[model samples]
Target: MIKSTDIIRCCASPHGIFWLTVAVLAIPNVALCFTERMGIMASVTNIVLPVAAVWLLMALGRRPGKTALLLFPLMFLAAFQIVLLYLFGHSIIAVDMFLNLVTTNVGEAMELLDNLLPAIVIVVVIYVPVIVLAVVSLRRGDVLSRSFLLRQRRRSLAALVAGAACMAGSYLAGRDYSARLHLYPLNVFYNIYLAADRYKATADYPQTSAGFSFNAVPTHAASGREVYVLVIGETARACSFGLYGYGRNTTPMLQRTGGLTVFSDAITQSNTTHKSVPMLLSAASAEDYGRIYREKGIITAFREAGFHTTFISNQRPNHSFIDIFGKEADDWKFIKEETERSDMYDEDMLRMVNDILDKKRAKELIVLHTYGSHFNYRERYRRSEAVFRPDNASEAKVSNRRQLLNAYDNSIRSTDRFLSLLIRQLDRSGAVSAMLYTSDHGENIFDDGRRLFLHASPIPSYYELHVPLLIWMSPSYRQMYAAEAAAVGSNSRKSVATSASVFHTMLSLAGISTPLRADSLSVASSSYKPGERHYLNDHNLPVAIKKILRGDEDFVMFRKMNLKY
Candidate 1:
């Protein structure tokens, strides 16, 4: 048997260090084979091309130390890839994922990282040593032997030729394969470029949309008193709500509440909050997301229609379109900015709503953006709301799924209570009123064999896209608009895209007439029609759900729920 000392010496050698660096760099590429869906040729080329490129660089450089150091940037990419793989299970680094790094606040980041200890540990163990080795090798002036370098260079050239051939073969065989799209570092770099481009566009939004208008007008008499509230929930999955046939009584209050219509088959166009929320608030859909940069949101439409629009949000501003659109309201306040407290709950937003209602404007439109059922789920609700016991999961691990789910269910219960109370307040207002509630997107809670556990993955799972959409109309409003109320109930089981439907439906419910509104997309309209669903991809392009959804499991789930994919 070889001694431990012998193994150490071999590892300490320049060749060993060079190979180690290549292997470490190849981790993400190798991982893509298992995590991503690709055919045999595409998978083989993905691994071979990237590895060959690394080998070529090392051999061509002659000095293994400097070459490894030159490739050090990839170490960071590898760490990011591994962590994402641990969290999402598939797909390359997306533009939104990159943007989220900048937009995610310290509190939110810590909450996510707190549960990602295992993945973080794995990243640290795999990368830290290789990084140290690269530094040490560089300082020691380590060089590859001339003979070894020549051999490696020849092998790398052959591998590159084979890889190129396989890539071409994959395309010829009708598979979609490209090095920049399928390969690791190349795809990651392209996404970085995309993220930067999007950031620049976001910075320029004010100027781009400065002169845009909804040209809105009221269909009802301007003298009539109206109160409409749009509640945008965060990370609330329909599968966890009692109103949507969940096993638990998470939404007991909502279930019992009269005149409430639950859109059981609602799905979001985008999974990330920044994209999804903007879509919900604006006329922008997966088919026309680019229009967001050149148009104002639904708040502006309401304001133009002679309603006193107010935006009250429990979430902290992330300097995205959400902030821009919220600020467009006649009156707006971000609760977190005023409170400066981490434990601020959704109920705080209710107080703001009460304050606005007290003003008793002739026509009012209030948007409540609640911090609903986000991670650290237990904190979303009060202790009294924790009807589901043993919900104190310290870490976000699959092993602690029961506790995590319990906490999530409790938060949903709290939401149920919050909505019920809001409805009661509306009933008491004695104005022609309606409330529309839907989430920006749903959450994944280690739900299945895939083990996905969050929103905003590059590719969304069934849970992440499926959300709960509810509408509550006051008795007076329902009696006044009987046809609209009946239409809402009729469309309850329809395949609805909240991003498109919410904007049109809200206007319909409020009796607003805007040229931008489409009757077919409005759930409240008698002309409502359920169309083919689409997803807003990373590049801001609309892709049919059937074309984008990959896994058989996701298709099965969509079919099982009778939802169009």
Candidate 2:
């Protein structure tokens, strides 16, 4: 028979109590994960929550047992599910936020549940054990009685402090490295979480001076011109396009067209479209956006200038930051292809654009925002019929990754085909149609070894910033604005531009004037300089771009960031 003390030691071990504490403490950390971006399940979330729970209970003198250990798996599973909710919660919340806005929860849970399986599996695998232990601990309450545990564990106080430090330190490090650029110190964890957004928005503030802010362009010209079309692309970083020196034939038609002004060195001020689009049209840098006056965004400027401005986007109107641009557009239409609801190609948007062009009967500015090259690549593209498979499987037996990429490229090709038609239509209309095409950002395009596609920080390399910007002025408009054409084509040093200059450039093209317009950005203005480009990351930090512009020998060899605007 086993000795009585040996049996007692087994019953009094701390593992059981520790696991139970974790299950309880996990509730809050899982909740915070949802506030970031949609669709993520970081492994870091797995360890921290439970450890904190154990730390809290052990700090008060609790000894664990077989029952508590048994509870571990079950709680672990539940915690996993909660992390899934945290990651894709925004997408799921689409139904919830929408339902609550309209008061309908009929399909809320089910819809979120469908996309949640991957995250769910990951969570259940991690948490199931802890959950089982929590239940077992509650049932065998007598053996693990609270008062007896407190008295027995009184001498373990030093170990408790050490364990708590480990737990707290892990959470702090994970929060900083995993989310905030690995930038903040440990003590600043709470402060970092609290002030993340304020920092991103603060970028626009530094650009503002005294009485000025972002550019304020009137929608209509004093001359009362016709229509202007702004085609805003998605995830189309310039680093990949052949026109910008990539080996691919991404923009042949754009290159063939003589009137298109390709900005070889244009940089986006923000990493994600959510931040970039607002900064672009809002007429401010990420640093100086809202110093004093809340200047209107692109469409807002057009509206204020007396034009009926509208926005047609393939991106979900409610997808996180789409609202940043969507809210300012006088008319907003979000076309999500995944719904299988709309019967339109990119060109079909032309019908709507044409309708507005006719209905307005005066000058107009139209913005067509695309959902091009977004991941879930297969869904974005047409069925691939191309013979060249990257992985050498020309047949249909290819992996999901290969097929997904092929599908994505096909989608880009389809967009190109649509653009060709759009340009032809604009040319045939007999009215001046000035078209400017630029993506909010670019895609990864399988450049990095990372399996999944991502646009924001951590993986934000040059591929995300170098985007194709093709501006084409209709023949009549070109004739009228020949000096602008010469300025754009000139090899002079002053033509350089950051995405911030796009607002001023468009305003100048449309004969609209804005206070923030620099001479280089305005064809109407004679003042110009060369060799200046400012690029910003998701955080709106200038360090990366500044290095490239300072004639860093590495960038100089590649002729990278020094492009004329």
Candidate 3:
């Protein structure tokens, strides 16, 4: 056997050093591809990128400093693999995930670190050796003779040609596999470049109002003081709610409560709050996101309709949507100051509501944004309030699935209680009030055979899209607008509904009409049609949840049941 020192000396040779540098830069990409179960051809396609980059860089100029620069990207590539392997249970990092990370704020980052500290530690431990080896190899350099340089250049040129051929062949042979290479860390540099451009674009985006008013008219004559309360819930799935046929009585208060209409088929606009909330509030489909962002939302429309608008949030302040529309509210209050810690509860928002509605104005539009049932579900409600016991799996980071389910159910119970309290307050106030409650999106708890465990997966599933939607109209309010109330109750059981319908429904509930409103699709419209259930995201492609849930054939069959209106 060769001695360790001899092996080191041999690898320190000019040719050995050059090849070692190439291996160091390329191994991370190769390892990631292999771990991801990429086919040989697909692996070759990914391996070619960084290898070609290093070969080209070295072939053009064999400088130590220049070659050392390649290590930075290699380190990033390795780090990405390690972190992804732990967090997502795979080593594939997509463009959207990268963008989410790039745009994440400091507070969000801290929260992430708190949850993922173990994963971070594992990443550091695993990549430290590779980093040290790269550094050591960079420090030791051997100058090649003229003839050797020429020979190496010829070989590298040949290798470059072969790599290019492999890439083309992989694409031709396995298009889908090759396409997925965009998720590999070999594209990290490109993704970072794109992210920087996106950051600048978002920053340069105008903070001022979209200015154009819909100037909608109320179809019905005004009655007593109109109190429309819009509750934006967070991460509560429909399937888990008792009101939506959940096995557990997670919504006891809602079940017993009168004048509360639950829409069975209510789905979210998107899986993410950042996308769903903004799009829904603005009456913007994913197709026309930019245009809607440039224009005012329903808050502005209510304001234009001469309603006293108040935005009370238990969520973090200065969110993108909150910044735009919430700012436009006549009275805006956020009870939860710090997002990292859970100090304020959803019940605290009720206090803010009491303060705002102490004396009601002519027409009051109160938007309550709650941090209901977000991740770490047990923390969302007090331990004493937990109806489902042995709920330590999520808190202890164990895989006791029953415990996880229990914790989730407990959070829903808390939400039910909070909603009950709000309803009681509204009833006691004796104002003509109506409250609309719908989550920003749903959560996944390994329900399907796929074993998906979170919201925001690249793959679309019914669990992440279906959410609980309910409207509570006080006796006084229902009596004031009997026809409108009947219309809302009639459409509550519609087989298909989406968060996009919220805008038009809100307008209808408020008796405010705008040319922009699609009354046919509104739940509060007598001519209610489910329409096509298309889920939107930041991605260009519109996800048809209807098709995903009830296959293409069934979706077609179901749509036939509803009239086009």
Candidate 4:
């Protein structure tokens, strides 16, 4: 048996330290093999390429330890990747994830971090020691002998050749195994580049869209009093809503209300609010996101049609496209900005709506951006709305799923009451009114074995894509626009609908005609027709929904709902 001192000496040797560094760097690649389900050849190339890269660095550097410090960035990325994998299960780093890093508020970040402690612990345990070892090696000034360096360099070259051969074989087999797409560090870096490009485009949005116009005209005469409200909800998944056939009575208030048409097959084109909310507000769909850069949102369309438009939001602005679009309204305010707190309920937005209704403009379009059922759900509603018990769990672990869901469902109940009250307020105002409600996107709550929670995963689940879309026409409005009301009711369950329909449908409901409006996409029009559903991929490209459903669970879900993916 070897002595402890001998083992320690061996570990401290230049060759041993180099191997340690390689192993530490390979941890993420090994994790990727499981998370991404890489093929044998692809996995081999993934493992070998990094080994060769680190070996080459070791061979080229005059002092190995000093050179290893360059790898700190890679180590940090690895830590981040590991945490994301733990949260979302699979997929590479996405541009939206990077945007969220900057867009998410301090309170929201702290709430998320509270649930992410387990992953954080693992990352610290794995990476902290490596950092300490790197410093120690640098202080020791360890150097490999010239002969040893030459031998290692040759081995590294051979390793690179083997990795290249594996890549070649994978390509010949018709696998899309490109280094820029499949490899870890390269793919993550490419996502960073994409994020940077999107940031630049966002900065240039005002100038790019300055000259765009809807040239909208109202078909209905401006004599009558008309009120239209679009309530944009946050993180409210369809599967949890009682109106959508959930076992819980999460939406009793809305269920009891009359003239509500529920679209059973509604889905959002994108999961992230920053992307999805803009799509809902603008005429852009995933198929034509480029239009978003060139055109203003529906608020502008309504304004041009000679309506007094107002936007009231429960969320704080992060200087995103959402803010730009909201400001296009004649008047807009972020409720969170006024309160300086994140715990305010969705009902806070209704006060602004009530104020606007009291103003009694002849023709008005009010958009209420609600903080409906967002995470840390207990804080979203009052204690009386906590009909679902034991909803106090703050941690996001799967074991506490029942409590988390209780809180989430309770928040939904609160949203139901808020909507019911708004509808009542609108009805009492005696305007020829219609209200359209849809979530920015849905959420995940450990619904299945995948253990996903929250929205905006690089890869979406069935829960994240499916959302509730409802239309409620007041009695007087239904009487005035009988055919449009009937058309909306008839088309409620006719086909798969997307949040893209919101702009055209709202315009149709208000009898606003614009060259930009597509009647085929408007559910309130007799010309409406169903079309294939698509999702916005991480790259912001339109992908056929069927192509992105990762497993049979998502496929079965769509099929059960009779939705064409």
Give the Cα lDDT of each candidate.
0.88, 0.52, 0.69, 0.86
- lDDT for 412 in candidate 2 is 62
Cα lDDT of model 1 overall? 0.88
lDDT of 2 by residue, 434-485 (tens): 8877777765444433322344442234556666677777888778777766
Q: Clashes in model 4: which pairs?
A: none
lDDT (Cα, 0-100) at 333 in candidate 4: 91
On lDDT, who's better, 1 or 3?
1
Candidate 1, residue 484: the lDDT equals 90
TM-score, cand. 2 = 0.67
User: Per-residue CA lDDT of candidate 3, range 1-565, in tens?
Assistant: 8899887666555555566567666656766675565667777767775577676566554543335455566657667666655544444554456556644456545654665566677767655644454456556643456676676677777776877777777767755644434434535555556556655544544653335778876555565667789888988888789887677889898899999998877777677776677666778775455555466778888888888898877766543554566777887866666345555779888877787678867788889888788766777898889899888765223355678789889989999999999998888887888889999888767553334455664444566677788989989878877877898899887754556778888888888877888888788878887766666633434666543442243234234323121
Model 3 residue 335 CA deviation (Å) reads 2.1
What candidate 2 gets wrong by more than 4 Å, as runs, is 1-14, 17-54, 57-121, 139-225, 291-293, 319-330, 335-345, 384-401, 449-452, 491-498, 520-543, 546-565
Clash tally, candidates in order? 1, 54, 0, 0
Query: After superposition, which runs of candidate 4 have C-alpha atoms over 4 Å from their true positions?
Result: 1-17
TM-score of each: 0.96, 0.67, 0.83, 0.95
Q: Say what the RMSD of model 2 is.
A: 8.9
* Residues 63-133 of candidate 4: C-alpha lDDT, one tens digit per residue: 56766677788888888888888888888778899988877778778888888888999989877866666
Model 3 spans with C-alpha error above 4 angstroms: 1-44, 54-70, 89-99, 102-108, 136-159, 170-201, 204-210, 218-222, 338-342, 395-400, 546-565
Better of 2 and 4 by TM-score: 4
